[model samples]
Target: MNIAQLSGRGVEITDPLREYVDEKLSRLDRFHDQITSARVTLTVRDVKNAARRNRVEVQINVPNGIIRAEESNADMYAAIDKASDVLERQLRKFKTKFLKQRHEAQPQPEPGPAEQAAQLGEEDGEVQPEIVRQKRFELRPMTPQDAVFQMEALGHDFYVFKNMGTDSCGVVYRRKDGHYGLIEPK
Candidate 1:
C-alpha cells in the first residue's frame, strides 16, 4: 500500500519513522488486499505534557471504506504501535462482518408505494441553516446492527450507512441513555 507520512506541528517525519510506519502498516494487506493507500500523521501536542505529546494518526483507505486510528504516548514509536494495533482490530471486525453478510441469505420485503412516501415536508419559514463544514465518504450498505458495530468501532456518536435490509439510507446513533437509536426513511 502507498503510505504517506505527514509531519504536523512540532513534529518531523524522518526516514526512520517513515520506514517504521510502512513496515507496520504493510501487515494490514493480509486482512484486506483492497487497501488503496494509507496516511500517517505525527503530531507533538503540549510540550508541558511530555508523556502524551507524541501523537500518531493513521488513515487507511480501502476499496469499500476508510479505517482510522489515533494514539498518543511519550514516544512516537509507541504511539504508532498503539494506533496500528487499534486499526488492525477495526479491520478484522470489518472483514468478519463482510464475510458473514456474504455467506448469509435472507429475504426482505420491499416497501410499498404509500409506505415509501416522503416523511419530511418543506418548511415555509425563510430561515436557512448554516452548514460550516461538510464531509464526503463512501456510504457502505449494511444492516442497522452492523451500523451500530461500525459506529462503536470508530468511537463515533453516530454513523450513516445504507440499510441493505430496507434498501434505503439510515442513521444509527448512540442515545443519551447509552442505548442505540436508528433513523430511517418512511
Candidate 2:
C-alpha cells in the first residue's frame, strides 16, 4: 500500500481529508496486489453548486496498465468513496479479463518484424531508445465501418486494422468533436 498524493483545486486538503482518502484507497491493494503507486487529485469545481462541486480522481499504476477512476459529489468524502468504489470495480474487471485471456480462445495475430526485433533486443540485452512498449497482435482485415465499431466496443480512443477494401493498414479513432476519423496508408 502507498500514500495517495492529495491535491486540491479550490479547497484545502485538511489532515482529516488526507487521512480519509488514504484509508479508503488502501483497500484497493486487497483487490490488486501488484499496484505500485497511486495518485489522487481532489478538486472543488463550481463553488456555487455545492451539490456537485467536489471531484475526486484516482490513478493507480500497476505492472500491466494504469487504472483511473473519477467521481464527483456534493461532499468530498462522498466523492472519495465513489472514486474508490469505481477503482475497485475496474480492478476486478481487469483481473477477470487477464484470467479469461489466459484460458479462453481468441484470435491472435502472428508476430511481425517489430516483434522479432524486440525479441532480439531482449535476448541481446540491447536497449531500444525509441520504443517504450511493444504489443503484437494479428492485424485482422476489416472495413472502416467495422474498425469504428471495434474501437467503440473496446472502449479505446483508437483502433488499428488492416483495411480490407484498400488492402492497407488503417487507423480509426475517436475525435474530440464526438466523431470518428479514419487514417489509411497513402
Candidate 3:
C-alpha cells in the first residue's frame, strides 16, 4: 500500500497522530490492492462552538475512480475513526461493483431476442426502469461563480456549463453546508 500524504490545517500534526493515521489507513489494502494513492487531510476549524471542530477528509485513488470520505467531530481522533469507517464501506461497495461489471463484461453465449431484452432490463439481479423524460439545454460558457448563480436561479442542485477559463466542461453544485463546489476534468 502506498503511504498516504497527511496534512493539517490550523493544527500541528504530532508523531503519534501520524503513526495512528498510517496504521488505520494501511488496513484498507485488504479491501482493494490496486489503490494507487491516498490523501488525508486533518483540519481544525476555528469556530466558537467546540462541537465538530475537527475534520478528517480522505481521498483514495483507484484504477477505476476516486473514493472520498469526510467526517467531523469534537476530537480529531474520533473524526479520523469515523472517516476511516466511511472509507471502508465505500471501498467494499466499489469492489463489489467492479467485480460485477467485470463479470458482466465477459463474452456470453448468444441468447434469444426475448432473453436479451430481459437481460438488458436486469443488472446485478435488479430490474432497471427505462428513462421517462429527457431535457436539452445549451452549455453556455461562464465562470464557476456564474454557474453557481445560474444553478440557484434555476433552483437546481447542480448545473453543467462550459468553463470560461479552461474552455472545458464543468459542473457547479451547492454543497450541503450552503457553500458551492466546482468540478472540472483533470
- lDDT (C-alpha) at residue 96 in model 3: 77
Best-matching candidate per lDDT: 1
Worst 10 residues of 1 by lDDT: 111-120
- Candidate 1: pairs in clash: none
Flag the better candidate by lDDT, 1 or 2: 1
Return the TM-score for each candidate structure: 0.72, 0.58, 0.57
lDDT tens digits, residue span 1-186, model 2: 695466888888898998899889888888888888888889987756445488998878665455778788888898899988888887887766656655866534322222122222244457556777897755777666656655653458878888776777877777667886666655
Position 39, candidate 1: lDDT? 78
User: Any runs in candidate 2 off by more than 4 Å, and if so which?
Assistant: 47-52, 103-107, 110-156, 159-186
Ranking of predictions according to lDDT: 1, 3, 2
Alpha-carbon lDDT, every model? 0.77, 0.72, 0.74
2-68: candidate 3 lDDT, tens digit per residue: 7568899988899999988888898899999999999999999977765549999887877635677
Q: In model 2, what are the clashing residue pairs, if there are any?
A: 109-138
Tens digits of per-residue lDDT, candidate 1, 43-63, equal 887766445578888888765
Candidate whose TM-score is highest = 1
RMSD of each: 5.5, 13.0, 15.5
